[model samples]
Target: MGGFTLDDILATRKPRDSWWTVFMVDPLACRLALLVANHTSITPNALTRLSMLIGFASAAAFTEGMLVAGAVLFYLSFTVDCMDGKIARLKGTGTPFGLWLDYVGDRVRVVCCAFGWGFGEYTRTGDTDVVLAAVGVVVLDLFRYINGPQLKRVKDATRALLETRLEGQYVLAESVLRSRPRSELEQAAAEFEQTAEDTGATVVDLQKAFHARFPWYDRFRVFLVRHRVRTHVVSGIEFHAAVFVVAPLFGAAALVPVAAVAGTLLLTFEMFLVYRVWLASRQVPRTAAEREKILV
Candidate 1:
């Protein structure tokens, strides 16, 4: 369990993760994590620093219009970024400062790569749209990193409020869906509703509206979860890969359009979650004074 083997290192991964990581990144990262953990006494923060340097090198590659080389370097940079996490989990050397370093490194890499490809392609063709694509990519990344965590916070606060008012543990739809299998999710939702009917438990399903309209969605969710993918298939991770790796393979003209498509897909699914969270929050029972305060 000291990360002497690839599987030992891989056991450190989150229960569910980005599908790209589960499929593409983890395969290479686990082995690398094992190698580094066994040989080097490198701290996670040190690995984070190395990752940022590789990411900057990727940006340099992109600036030179070495499209394939840039793509490869970008992937390698992300591989190192992921490896740091696994190595930390394996060695139990994780720290809050390391988390901060990792987060900052990721944002910086995104910014560098965005402008890297934008200016690189702009130089090649003198098309200003590529620059716009870079701006859009950064905007999307900002919205995700900022709003996503805040949404989770709001959901947690709502759950706290409900459990306080109702005097029983409440099962939230969003939490259950994200963490459980389809059958277990349905059972949990049903049990929550039944408990609410019989006692003081409050039921708030972020998924209620969506599931009612599209009953077949659990099947899709099952398929995605089986692959360690989530309902939001085109997350920021995929957006970055699509922009930096997949689109560039087709050359500069494809870069801007692919970025646009990737950004659109990311926002659409994110908006769906935001709306559902809002809807679910409304179902939380509030005292008249609390409702008045909200209105004020």
Candidate 2:
């Protein structure tokens, strides 16, 4: 018998998705993932490998000046790429190796496609700017991805430190008040405290968390998510879709400008995201190790 229904596959998707995946990629990926998960013995790692091969083929198509083929192939590759994650989450078969492969595969695909497009157009037009645009694409893509993991690491560390402090606050509140906490934040921290004390386990989520500081931010996020798009409007997914899928329709002359505009938009959103993260960090007091690391 099959593992999951089509509805089950759809439910395996992220709580929120980027605009490109939500609108362009996921609908088809979900349907395909449904079929593969139910009917085939194919694994998530295998799907990832297949997606990488398709992506490489798309890059090759671009290099050969097959714009229509390249665009279709790239879109197809992305759809398959989306499917692997869904299958992994749905089947509980995900591994650290699969995650690493997916991340590295995405970077390789972008790099290959950028170089292929630039070289193909340059061969026909003799425009050196295309080469520069290609290089810029590689650098910008690397910049975003490199920062993302590091930022996530920092956020994780901050949360750990914040949790410890909240635990302290919870203990003190219990000793002193023995009643309702002062604020909503204290109310949540107190509850978490009681649960952990009863179970002797770790509690990760501090309700009324970092977002609670800026209530409007939560509302903004909900509003965007309600429309099926994440707050990051021009993230890596949108950047690739713009450069590879959308730009090709306008011919070689449009590629550089399209890539340039895409890069700018990506940077703008990314920097804004960094600023928001910094502000969120300020809400949580730093630990001694964090302070020392910053100094170094």
Candidate 3:
């Protein structure tokens, strides 16, 4: 019997996926992963390591100016990359180390591919500009990827602090007024406070509390996610394939710089959007008490 059904593979997808990934690459990769699922002994981390190994091979091929070979290997590496998560979700074997490996492996792949492009172009035409473009690709892409998650971390921490501090004020009020309050409204408040004190919330819970408080923030997040199609092409494996595979088919290493420049510009715009969303999230009132009356 097959370890994964079609629905099981589909269930591993992110809520907001790029059109190319959703329609093209992911479906094919998931099907392949499902076929291989009967093997049972292969783990997600093993797939991750395998993907990284193939990624290094892709980089070496690019460095040798074997564009078509590099491109094919790049796509294969990416397909394997997608497989790791699919396998993890299929087997319920996702781990913190698996996630860490996936994230770090992605960064390593970017660095290797970037340098490969520079080295390949240098071997072809000896242009110093190729090196500069590689640097820009790494800088802009890393900035966009790293900053988005870090900003979200900041927002989570700030929201948690606000929830705790504001609730502390309420607790202090209840402690000081123990002798004076016996009305029906006060009894309800006391009960609610007791319940809140008993059930402590995590950072994620506080973020959800804020999400409930601000409908627009939730809507805006959805909007950003849905509108990411424009930046999707020059990201991930697609970027490498465009430069390494398609460029050589046309006999033009010039496409290397072109992709690097386009990726930089796309990521710059994405960074701006990320910053705007983070700013908007920060503008929301953090305290649930303050946000209770108005739906932001």
The candidate that achieves the highest lDDT relative to the unseen native structure:
1
> Candidate 1: which stretches are off by over 4 Å?
1-3, 173-206, 291-296
- C-alpha TM-scores of all predictions: 0.87, 0.81, 0.68
Clashes of 2: 0
List candidate 3 segments past 4 Å from native.
Answer: 1-3, 161-251, 286-296
lDDT of 2 at 15: 73
Distance from true location, Cα of 2 in model 3, Å: 3.7
**Which candidate ranks first by TM-score, i.e. highest?**
1
lDDT of 2 by residue, 31-74 (tens): 99999998897888999899899999989998988887888889
Off by over 4 Å in 2: 1-3, 168-219, 286-296
Write down the lDDT that model 2 would get: 0.79
lDDT of 1 by residue, 209-240 (tens): 66777778778887877677767777888888
lDDT of 3 by residue, 1-296 (tens): 45567788877776545545665578788887887686566889999999999989988987887767777787778888888888888788778899999988988987897789676778788888777777776776687577668767765555545555556333322232323322233555556567777554211222333344554654444444554333234454455445545555555456555666567656665665565445545643555665553323
Superposition error at 232 for model 2 (Å): 1.6
Error of 1 at 137 (Å): 1.1
Candidate-wise lDDT, in order? 0.82, 0.79, 0.64
